[model samples]
Target chain A: MQNEMVAMLLAGGKGTRLFALTKKVAKPAVYYGGKYRIIDFPLSNAAHSGITRVGVLTQYESVALNNYIGNGSHWGIDGNNSVAGILPPRQTDEGASWYQGTADAIYQNLDFLDNQNPEYVLILSGDHIYKMNYAKMLAYHKEHKADLTVAVLNVSLEEASRFGIMNVNDDYSIYEFEEKPKNPKSTLASMGIYIFTYKTLRDALVKDAKNPDSEHDFGKNIIPDLLAKKKRLFAYTFEGYWKDVGTIASLWEANMDLLDPSDPLRLYKDDDFRILSEDARDLPQFIGKNASVKKSIVNQGAIVLGDVSSSVIFKGAIIEEGATVKDSVIMPGAHVSSGAYINHCIVADNVFIDGSRRENEDGKEVILISK
Target chain B: MPHILGLANLHGAPKLGPITERRSIASTSFLGRYAFVDFTLSNFSNSGIDQMGILVEEKLRSLVRHIGNGVVYNANTKRGFCSIMYNEQYAPAPAYNNDINNLIENHWVLDQSNADYIIFAPCHLLYRMDYRDAIKYHIQKKASVTMIYMKCSDGKNSFINMDELKLDENGRVLEIQKNKGAKKNINVSLETYIISRSKLEEFLEFAKDTSHFFSIRDVLSYMTGQLFIHSYEYQGYLRAFTSVEDYYDFSLEFLNPKVLNELFVPEWPIYTRTNDTPPVRYGEEAKVSNSFVANGSIIEGSVKGSIIGRSVIIEKGAKIENCIVMSDAHIGANAKLKNCIIDRYAQVLHCNDLKGDPKKPLIVRERDIV
Candidate 1:
C-alpha cells in the first residue's frame, strides 16, 4: 500500500553542547521532561498526525537511541499496516560511509523510502520540544500544491541572524533563503521541518550527491539549490511551543516549562494530544515526611525526601533527606545525598552526589553533572 | 515446562464495603496504577505459567476492562492465553456462586490446557510468590496439595477471619480453621493452593456432591486430614484485604520504606496496564511528605502519609493526611481530610472537614460529588 506521507526523523546529531548527556547517547535519546526522551516529540507528533510509516536516521552514538525506538511500537507506528524502522548507515554493496549531512542521511535511505512509495516525504529533526500535528502542515502543502514546504517559526529580528532565515513573498512563498546572513531580510526562521514531493526531493538529492562542493545538508545545499532553480518553496507558519534544546540551559528550561500551568505545552491539560512513550513500569513516586516539593514535575519510581523547587525529577532518582534541589533537572537513577545542595544544574543519569554542594552562587550558569 | 495453569480465584474475596460495592475486589485499585488482580497475574507471568484463568464472581465489567487480553501481564498472544472464566449459570444465585462452580462451568479451560497442575491464588491476598518454587516443593513432598502460608506477627489484628493452618511436626496440615484473633503470632493461610489436576478434579466432584455453595477452600478445609496436605511457608510480604479497615491500613503501610521494599523487589516486577499520563506535577504551594504519588496528578495542597492515584487534583489549602485517594479524585480548596479512602473520581468539594479515626477510614463512594 502506498502511504500518503512518510516521516524521516534525523536523529544522528551528537549535540556536543549537551556534553556528557550525549557522550554515550545521541541527542535524540537525551532525557526530556521527567519521563520522555527528546526524540519522542517528533515521533509522537507523527503518530498523532496519522503518519504510520517512519524511518529514524541514526548515526553518532546511535546504539541507545536505536534501542529506544525499537520498531516504534510505543508510538503505535509499528506492526500491522505500519512501518517504523531505524535506518543506520550500513555497508552497502557500493561502499560504507557515515551520514555526511541531513540530506545525505535521507538520501542513503532512499531504498527504504522507495519500498513504501509515499506521495510526500516529511523531513523532521529530533531536536526541539513541541507538540505539532504534521498532518495539518501536509494539508497546507497540498492546498498550495508546492514542490517543497518548509515549516517556519517567527523569531525576533535581532536573533534572526543565528538561524537559517526564510525571505518569503506575501503569499508565504519563499523568494530568497539565507543561512545565518549578516543582514537579515525577514524574521521567519526555518524550524528544520520540511515536506517535499517525493520526485522533487529525490531529484534534488541525487543531483546534490554528485556535487563535490556541496555539503549535502538541507539548509546549506538543497534549499538554496532549489531556490536557484526557481522551484516552488513555501513557508508554513507554526505557532506553538517550539524550543531547540541544544544546550544545557535550554534543556533545563524546556523541562521547567512543563511545570508551568500556563505554558503553551501544558502536558497535564492536553489529554487528547497525549505524548506516548515506552512504559518504565516502575513503582509510584514517594515523597518522604520531611520533603517539600513545589513547582516540580516528578516521574514514577522517584523517591524524594528533601526540599525540591522548580525541577524535573526522573524515575528511580533519589533525593535524600536535607538535600536541596532548586531549578535543576535530575535524570533517571541519579541520587542527591543528604546535605547536598544542587541548583541550576543538570544531573546526569545515575550520577551520585554524596553530601556535596553544587550550586552556581550567582545562579548565572548551568552546571552539567556526570559520572 | 509442566503445563501448569493458574486460577485467580476471586470468589473467596471478602467485601471491602463501598469500594467493592460496584466492583469485585480483584479490580480494586491499589497503590496508584495497579489493580488487585495485577499481583496475581504478574505472579503467574513471573512464574512462567502462561495458561491462566481469572475466576471472577461479580462485577466483571470493571475486571474485564482492566485485564483485557492479559497482555500487560506478559501473557503471550500466540502460544499462551489468559482466559476470563465467569460463571453465568450461577450469576443470579449469589450463595451458590463459588470458585468451584466457576471452574466446573468453565471446564473448557481445564480440558483445553491439559494442565498437569492447577495453582489457585486469591486476588484479595497481595503478595509475590513464584509458583515454580511451590510446585517444586509440592513435588518434593509428594503431597496431593500444597498450601501457601505466612507466619504473621500481627495475626491478632491483621489477617482476621482468614484461614489459619495448624501444621504438625512433619509439616502436615492437621487442621484448617479461622483466626479468631486469639494469638499474636500464628500461621495464616494466604488462600493460595497448588493442587494436582487429578486431585483438583476429585475435589470438584466432591464439592458438587456435598453442596452447591461449597467453595474450593471449604472443600480443602474439610478434607485436610484425609488428604496428604503440605504447607509451604512464604517469608516475603503479604497483605489480606478482609475488611475496609484492612484495606486502608495495608495501603497506608506502603508509605514505610521497609514495608514497601519487601514486595516491590526490582527482580520481581509487578506489571499493570500502561496509561498515557504525564508525570506528576506539583504546584507552587504543594507540600508533600511520605506519600505515594502517581502520574498525571496536579497537587497544590499539602499531603502527608497518603497514596494519591493517577490524575488526581488537590487544590491549594487542601490538607490531606493518612489517606488513599484513588485515580481522578479531586480535593477542593481548604478541604481537610484525614484517614479516608476517597474512591476514584470522587470530589470533596463542599465537605470541608471530613475526618475519621485511624482504625476506621471514612469511605467516599466512587464518582461522588460530596
Candidate 2:
C-alpha cells in the first residue's frame, strides 16, 4: 500500500551551540544517551508512525549523517515500497545554493514531492530529541479539514514568549501566529513541526519564493502569510516529553532525562517509543573487578575499570584504573586516564583526559570538545 | 567471493532442554546477545563468501526470523544471496533429515553458483576463522576435500560428539572415528569443509548411488579410506557445544580474559540482528564486579562473576554470581541467584533463593516465572 504522506527532515543545521562536537559532524549526527544519534528519535518516530517515504534534506557537514542513514535499514525504512533518501543541495538550472530556510529547503525539493504525489507533507527538524507519532497529527489535520497543521505544545506563558505562539480559539482553530512575541496572549508554542496539504504547500512555496521582503522560512514568513490568507492552520496539541536539543544545556538535560527510571522520556522503558540507532558491532560493556558504577548508562565496547556515577558512556569509551566519572557524558572512544576525575562534563568523541580533576564551577556541564 | 553452502544439520542435539525446546541449536542465544548461527554467518560474511544456502531440516522459524533476507550480514546483495533450502519430502521423518538430502534438495544453489571452491560449514562449533587461507591450502594440496579441525580440550570432552580425524605425517586423513570421550587434547573435526564444487557434486553422486537414506557424514566416514582428505589444523580457540554441560562450560569460558579477547577480536567482527536497546544503566546501589553486561540491561543489585543479557532488570538487594541471565529475565529485589542459567524472560521472584552446582548449572525455562 502507498503512504498518504511524505516527510522532509531539515537536518542541515550547523549547531554552533554544540561547540567542539559540531566542528566536524552535523548536529543530527551528534550521539546522545550513549546509544543513539539525535536524528534517530525523529526517524524512529516516523517509522513507528508508518511514514514510508522520507527525504532527509542535508546541508553543512553531512558525511556522517549521510552514511548512517544511507539505506535507512536501521530504522526499517529501506523496504521495497518505502524509501529514505538523502536530499543534498545541488547546482541546477535554477542555480546552486544551500538550504536558505526551512521552507526553502522543501521548495528546492519540490521535484521529489511531485514524484511521490503525496496527499500531505510532514516537515521536521533534525536537532530535536523527541518521539512523536506524526500519523496522529496527520489524522488531526484531516479531521479539521485544514490546509496546514502545526504541532504545538502548551508551554509556560514566560517560555511561550520565546517561541512562536499560536493564538488558537477554544475549538483549536489557529487564528493568529506570532514569532517570539513580547506580549503573548497564548502559550501554545510551535514545535517547528508542520503538516501541509501537498497542493497548499506547493502553492505557498511557489508564491513565497517570488515575494519580496520574505525570509523563505516557515515560522518567519510562510506561516504568517497562511494566517493572513485565512487558511485553515490548525494547531495540534502534543502532550509528551519533547526537547529542541539545539544547545548544550538542553542536550545535557536530555541525556540526564534518560537517567531517571521513572522519567516519561526514559530512553529504554517505553515500548511505543523505540528509538532505533545504527549498530555498534562491538563487544558487551565490561566492568572490571575494581569498577564501581552507580546510576550510569554504559554502552558497548566500554571498559570501565574505575568509578562511574550518573553518566552516559558511549561505545569504546574507557575509564582507566582509578579514574572517576560523575555526571558526565563520555562520547565514543573518549578516555579518562588514571586518577582523572571528571564531573558534570561533556567529553566529545575520541577525547582524552588525564591526571586532573575537571569540574565546571559555572554549575553547568563543562563542554570539552575534542580537537 | 567463493561459493558457500550451509548445512543447517539437525545432527547436533538441540537438547539444552528447555532452552532448546523451541529453536534449533543454530538459533540458540549465546553469550547474552548473539545466536550460535551468528558466529558462522558472520565468519562467512566477513570472509567475503556471500553466496550461501541454509538447509533447514527442522525448527526453521526461529532461524528464518533471525536471518531475514540477510541484509544486515551484507549477504543479500545482487551479486550473492542467502537462500533457505527445505526438503519437503524428508523434513517430517527424523531418520531421513540428514545432510545428504539437504544438499540434494538445494543442489541448484551449488549448480548455479559461479565459483570453483565451496565452503560447507555447520553452526555447532563457535570460532572466528578466515577460510581464505584454508581455501588456499585446499587449492595447493589438490585434495578433493580439506577437512577443518581444531585441537580441542575441555574437562568435559566426553559430551562432545565430534569426529576425530586420524592423519598421517603429511596431514592426509588415514582414518575417521566418532569421538568416544577423549580426556585430553584431541583433534575434533569442526565440520567445516572446503572442496571444489565439481568434487562436491561427485561426492553427492557417489553417496546417491549407495542408498537414499545414507547420511552425508556416514558417506564421508565410509569414504575416509578411499578419498584424498587433507586436514586443515585450526590453532585458534574453539568450543563445540554438543550438550548442556558443554554449553555452560563454554559460556563460562568467556569469563576468562584471554579466551574472551581471542573470541571477540576487533579484526573479525561477529554481526547479529542489532537491537535498538539503549546502553545498560547501573543503579546507585548496584555493586558490579568483573562482569560482562550487554546493552539495554539495568543493574541495581550486586552482580559478581556473571554475564547479563539485554533489557534485564536486576532489582535492588538481589545478588547474582556466576550466572548467565538471558534477556528480559527479571531478578526481583533481594533474590539471590548463583550458578544458574536463567532463560529468556524468566523471573525469579522477590527474595527467592536459587543455587545450582558449579559444574551443572540449573536451567530456568523461558518465561518460567519462578
DockQ of each: 0.86, 0.80
lDDT of 1 at B133: 83
Q: Which stretches of candidate 1 lie over 4 Å from their true place?
A: B75-77, B112-114, B153-155, B183-185, B205-211
**Candidate 2 C-alpha RMSD relative to the actual structure:** 2.2
Tens digits of per-residue lDDT for model 1, A1-371: 22789999999999999999999999999999999999988998999899899999999988999999997888988757889889999999998999999999999999998998989999999998988989899999999999999999999999999999999999999999899988999999999999999999999999999998989999989999999999999999999899999999889888878877785785766687789898887999999999999999999999999999999999999999999999999999999999998988999999989996756656788888999
**How accurate locally, in lDDT, is each candidate?**
0.91, 0.84
lDDT score, candidate 1, position A348? 97
In model 1, the Cα lDDT at residue A24 comes to 95
Q: Pull out the clashing pairs in model 1.
A: A287-B290, A288-B290
**What does chain B score (TM) in every candidate?**
0.96, 0.93
lDDT of residue A249 for candidate 2: 75
User: What are the C-alpha RMSDs, in order, of all predicted structures?
Assistant: 1.9, 2.2
